[model samples]
Target chain A: MNRSILLQSRPVGMPGPENFEFREGSVQEPQEGQAVIRTLYLSVDPYMRGRMSDAKSYVEPFKLNEVISGGIVGEVVESKSGDLQPGDKVIGMLGWRLYNTVDAGSVRKLDPSIAPLSAYLSVLGLTGLTAYFGLLDIGKPKAGETVVVSGAAGSVGMFVGQIAKIQGTRVVGIAGTDEKCEYLTRELGFDAAVNYKADNFQEELAAACPNGVDVYFDNVGGSVSDAVMNLLNDYARIPLCGAISSYNSTEDVGPRILSKLIKTRSMIKGFVLSDYASRQAEGMQQLGQWLAEGKLKYEETIVEGFDHVVDAFLQLFQGTNLGKMLVKVSDPQA
Target chain B: MNRSILLQSRPVGMPGPENFEFREGSVQEPQEGQAVIRTLYLSVDPYMRGRMSDAKSYVEPFKLNEVISGGIVGEVVESKSGDLQPGDKVIGMLGWRLYNTVDAGSVRKLDPSIAPLSAYLSVLGLTGLTAYFGLLDIGKPKAGETVVVSGAAGSVGMFVGQIAKIQGTRVVGIAGTDEKCEYLTRELGFDAAVNYKADNFQEELAAACPNGVDVYFDNVGGSVSDAVMNLLNDYARIPLCGAISSYNSTEDVGPRILSKLIKTRSMIKGFVLSDYASRQAEGMQQLGQWLAEGKLKYEETIVEGFDHVVDAFLQLFQGTNLGKMLVKVSDPQA
Candidate 1:
């Protein structure tokens, strides 16, 4: 028997852990061209909160009785296909479950020796690719220009600040806590970090970025985005990655200072990681090289057990997790 | 002596006639490198509303007690510069004055025989250039796509819809009245037009544009912009030209559909005509060619007398003007 969590109902505000219900079911045998994966880790991202809502969105909402799905890393327990064998590690979009029986073509084998398997869900996965495309493709940061990123201590934001630094741009970050701010500045190599919770957030931001922001990588949109909008230079670019601040709110209060977008001759574009799915391999190659060179650093906040999956997700809205939040679904070699 | 209207005070909302003080002043003789001009026409655009306020914007706010400046067409009464001669028709950014002295390099001498002198202040002037860059450069419309332009009966908006139609795109327009809607569709060759005053605006917009909007030329940016935002297709582009709706509001209430921007992956870019000043000549050439070929049409709402300039500007926000609103500053040369 395998265990998985299913969406119980849609949420209006911040979803409680009760919105999901854990259930046990018999594991199906791998059919032809199929492989069975023993769930190792499950990613918990803010974007997943949108999937739990019934509202119209880029992707379909999670059905009431279906398993909520996202990126997962696991080990192949059994194989009915010639392409895979037992003891193979792979990473793909598998849901919250102890075991998954999916087509072999859906999984990409991960060489555990090359990098830690968890990294496939972090720096070398959707997190890294999202930062790569959003900042470079949309933001278009130029050398000597200043780049500002919100949620800087989180997985994608951390990579965004570092990548902007690598391109010879001054990078400023906004995080939630003092500890995260220190980590972003000291370890992630951001030029400066502002704790958004501080009383003088707007002042600190202005002092840190005197040249005015040229590219703003928006992850936590709300007041933080509004403050940044005022400091944007003419013809600035904004890459909308996530709006974690509003994701939990029952009522939709759109980002303030949208009029500034017109006054400054700036651009605001929304992007989903899936939109760049076709060019992911190209992203992976460059990300892999950056990882090998130690030019990119990654961190993960891992919860101990499968039962804590819902708890891990809830932590994202409360700003409790640092970097990518993940649930250890089962023993690595189970 | 020549008559001119000077900015008496920076306005808080709509500028009343009292805000402009008409004064009589002597026209000075042209010094070396200067040309003395007798003004023929003056352009009154929605952007001038922003200049009337003291708020910081893309361009500098108009200084109190100075002449409100914009595009002007005139004839050189006398010249002390090599580039211009007496009776030469010229176009430039002169103010609300009947007669003025300008450096020869500041004005472009127009050949009145090729086109009417007022044409320099309309189709061959900044209004034409603004439409060209807003549509082609910013919107980047593809052939066979659908374009929706707000304030479609107005100066730049009319050109935007017509230009999109010229590129073989289905163009839909939103006007303030049934008469304006009829003029847009029947006279301007737009595929469809919707009178925004209709009770079922949303349904009418949907009916007018059966295909989703590919490019949105936003001029009236309030509820009208919100309605358009809801219908934007994936990868849709919005060239933000003007926001006439919010120009008169005392309180800050922005567009309510900003969340749609994220869901549809749409991009909204604010643009000022002066931002593309380096390429103004190219835009003027292209627009002039279209006008001369009779493929492009333009209308001018001529308000006579320099003293009534403020009235002409106020008419813009009321949605009363049908096309390019201009002030006839002086009698046309016989």
Candidate 2:
């Protein structure tokens, strides 16, 4: 029996676990040119929150009684296609289900010997690709330039800070708690980290970045973004990866320092990882090399059951996850 | 004797004639390394409106009891420095005064034989330089692309359309009156012109731009900019030269389509002509060549006297001037 969570209702503010309903169903036999995979690790992202609402956005909202789809790393249990063999591991945009039967072309074979299979859902996956393109393409960090990133403890933010450091630029991160801030500076090798929950967040951000921010990788918008914008240097670049702060807001509350963009001749560009789909292979190769060099570190807060997928997703909004939030649907077969 | 209007008080909205007080004073002789020039044409631009207020902006606000300075075209009457001789036409940043003394290095010698002396204050001056850099550098219009400009009949907007046309792109303009719109399309060779006052502005704008706007030279930032922003194609560039629409606003009201920038990967860059000071000579040489070739046509709405300079400046906010607004401080010395 395969278990899947279906969208039962649309969410208004933060989505509750009740919005999704788990149902058990029989796994069908794979057709020709298709492979059946048992889910191992399912990725949860902040953008999915936008997809849960019925509002108009870049992607369509999840339909009622349909399985929500995102990135997944799983092992091939059976294959009707010549490209894959039974027990082979692969990664692709697979939905939240215990088992999935998808077209062979939709999946890419993963090398488990190079790294752990779950690494495909973190450092070598969409999270790493997003940080690479968003920083290099949009942020355009130069050597000696100061880079500031919000949500520094999260999946994308962690990679963004480390990438800037690799580019020989000063990296300052803004996280929610003292522990996450410490983790960012100590484990991730960020130059400085500030706790946004601190009473003097703005002052701390300023003191940390005395030279002013040249590139701001904005993951969380609202007050945090507003503070960073005030500290932007002239001709600064902002790659707006996400605005998790305002994603749940029912009313539209746009960023306040929009006028500062004019005065400083700065730019704020929104990016989607899918937009760089053509360059995915190039990005992954570089990210994989960095991981192999031990230059990049990744952490995943895994929730241990298939039924707790909704709980893992909801934790993203509350800032409960330390790094990439993943749902470990099942243990790897030995 | 020379007469000059000095700033008296900052007005809330439009500066009435009362806000300026003219003082008749004797013209002082040029000291060592100084030259005396008789002002022929004085520019009245929307930016000067900002200088009249106490608010902080890119440029310093005009202080009370100080002379309001801007671009001026004049003929040297006396030279204390060997760099300039009597009867030499010059262009420089001089105020509303009919006659004044300035250092020789501060002025650029103009060849009146190449084009009219007033041309130095209009097409070959700061107005033309602004359009050149704002459109070409920031807007980055490619051949066959659709370029749109607001305040089309104004100084900067006129050059923006002509330069876009030179790049083999389709050009559209937005102006206030039917006469200005006619001039933009017929004389200036714009493909289309929209009268912002027309009831069917949105519809006319859409019909005029069938290919979608690729570059929007934003001179007026208000509802007009908002309308054009909505019709922008993906990767559109907006050269934010001026926001005359909000220059007089008592309350803070900016462009409404800010979020659209994120969706389309568009860029809105605010530029002050002075910021590109090092490249001013390069811009002038190109603009002068275009004017001499008759490829660029410029018009000036010259107000009769220095006393009406305040009225002429106020007319800019009201959209009364058809092209580059100027104050004829004195008759040319034959």
Give the per-residue lDDT digits (tens) of candidate 1, residues A1-334: 9988999988888899779999999898989999999999889888888899887778788999899898999998999999888888889888788899999999999988778888999889989999999999999999999999999988899999999999999999999999999999998899999999899999999999999999999998778887888799999999988888777775555443445777788998888888898999899999999989999889999998888889988998888778888888776663
Model 1, B198-264: lDDT tens digits are: 8999899988778888999988877787778778887789998888877777655544344566667
Model 1, residue B83: distance off in Å is 2.1
C-alpha positional error of residue B233 in candidate 1 after TM-score superposition, expressed in Å: 1.7
State the lDDT at A46 in candidate 1. 87
Q: What DockQ class does candidate 1 belong to? A: medium
Model 2, residue pairs in steric clash: none
After aligning candidate 2 to the native by TM-score, how far in Å is the CA of B260 from where it should be?
A: 3.1
Fnat of candidate 2: 0.26
lDDT of 2 at A269: 71
Superposed by TM-score, candidate 2 places the C-alpha of residue A27 at a distance from the truth, in angstroms, of 3.2
Q: Score the docking of each candidate (DockQ).
A: 0.52, 0.32
lDDT of 1: 0.86
